[model samples]
Target: MFDYYNLEPVLMWIHSTMCGLMPEWLAFTIEGIAVGIFIMVMYAVLAIILIYMERKVCAAFQCRIGPDRVGGRGGLLQVPADVIKILTKEIISLKNSDKFLYALAPFLVIMASILTFSCLPWNKGGEILHMNIGIFFVLAASSIGVLGILLAGWSSNSKYTLIGAVRSGAMIISYELSIGLSVLTMVILCGTMDIQEIVAYQENGWNIFKGHLPALMAFVIYLIAGNAEANRAPFDLAEAEQELTAGYHTEYSGMHFGFFYLAEYLNLFITAGIAVTLFLGGWMPLHIAGLEGFNTIMDYIPGVIWFVGKTFFVVFLLMWIRWTFPRLRIDQVLILEWKYLMPLSLLVLVIMTVMKVFGLVF
Candidate 1:
């Protein structure tokens, strides 16, 4: 069994040590910069890993050998090579394009993703920002990345890009309702917005089991809405390659396009992480009502391990769905959200609220 450990205290110690060597304000600034850089590096590494995983996964589904030539085994270096290629490629500048917004768009998308990471509880007492309104902060912050997508599409001075951007804006706005309602259902049951508190509430049992049907419904709805929000296949109308020729980022190349790609994978991870945190009990170990010994054994495992394991499980589910499903048409995407998911989400929320009032949860 792995003993529990947390990185927060170690980071705080480093911050304090730096404070002793510099002015207080300077130390604070330096700490912020360091944290930001750490997040960026982490994001880059995870993107590389996810890209490689996605390629291998898709290739497996298609029964083809994937990237065997790039690295020693299974082409592990393929992502790094792709990154170097992108970095070295020439970024075309369109004369008719809005220069400033076009350049700023990718950064905006990346920034939104980075900001969302701050409030996520990686383990017990391992969050960067423990705000009372953590759930709301996450929902609000994650939505801002859509603005970057819109900007990229609009500033590209291409009809294809503009159409893709419009489709993305409409799809995201529609799906977010279902996403918000699903999250709200969890909040109603937990009666708290703090991410850590919600997780702690599930120490004895996961919310999915506690809330039963409503919780399961919310989880399903969240997964669907989240996939759409991340613009994954079936909901990737905004970047339908066959129709829009790579959609909103069609005009982008080199590192600019790389940023959009990185943001997409990061957003996928964020969506999966939120699902794990809310429905799967965050870092809490599996604890059955009568199995104390088993629960105790689970407790000995590090919380971070449980958290990451649950998160990646959800990520794998999303990937599986992506490879299995066909892309939905733009009209079908809106219809799924507005006609089906939205109404069902609202109904689930009501059911959960009533259950909470009557003390009916498990």
Candidate 2:
């Protein structure tokens, strides 16, 4: 079993060590501002890598070399170059746009994306906020991301912005039902909403495989709903560039537009992380029914490795879905959600609930 309250002792040890080595002011500063800055820096670095990788992966899928010129054969520095370009470019907010809300929306969205990480259990032993309701907290806080989108569109005072905002708002709202239902099914099977506890349930096998048919169905529904929730690919009706001419950020320029782009990718990462936590068994490794040696080797690998590897796989899958399919019309997107995903998720929830009640789960 995992220690639910282990971080307190670890923090005490760090506090004692810090007292022995440095002044109180220095310790406080390191723990307070420094830690927050470190997390944001890490977020920025990760975002940059994902941005470069997304472009390269998209190019490769379409039979082209992505960024050969930026930093050598792979164009690894393409993202940083893009960043410098944005920083040096003009800030062109529209005359009709609500300046305050237009400027504030991107940061709000990005902050919400960063905030979701607080409850993620990166390993068995550590999380910034290891709450019993970690899953609920993450899902609830992440929904706030849509608010920024709505603000950006409505505040921008453009028809394109309003349409994109409305589309995103509707899509997110519709898909969230399916996402929530899928998660409820998992919670039913695992019997806990604590992300660590859910991971512990998967010590034998991932929840996707544990509950068999019902879990499998939930997984499919989650993939569809999660993709829509993140506003990616076929469900990216919110900002269909060919149609909306840039969607909600149509009136945005320079760093403002950069913030929206950054938020989209960050939200993608967060969506993948949530999916890993729920069905793929965040940080928990695969375990066959009878292979103790294989299981032991899996256990030897650190939890963060398992968590991040599964997350990146999901992220790649999202990219693949985006590049391979044509965007759906907004009405068609909602219909898919209401007519297909939501029903399937509700049915799966019922099935899983029955399975759990009868003790038929793996």
What are the per-model numbers of colliding residue pairs? Answer: 0, 0
Model 2 lDDT tens row, 1-362: 23433344787799789978999888888887765886678687878988988988999999998888978887888889989999899987778668999888888787778888666777876666678988888889888989999999999999999999999999998888998899899999998999889888887788888899998888878888888887889888889888899888898889888888888887788888888888898888777878878877777777788888999899998899889999999889878888988788888888899989998988
Model 2 residue runs over 4 Å out of place are 1-12, 19-29
How does model 1 fare in lDDT? 0.90
What's the true lDDT of residue 39 in model 1? Answer: 78
Runs off by more than 4 Å, candidate 1: 1-3, 6-21
What is candidate 1's lDDT per residue for 10-124, written digit by digit as tens?
A: 7779878988899999998887788778877878898998899899888988898788888797798889999999999998888888999999999999888888877777887
Candidate 1 Cα deviation (angstroms), residue 110: 1.3
Which has the greatest TM-score?
Answer: 1
- lDDT agreement with native, every candidate: 0.90, 0.84
Q: Please report, as a residue range, the 10-residue window in candidate 2 with the lowest summed lDDT.
A: 1-10
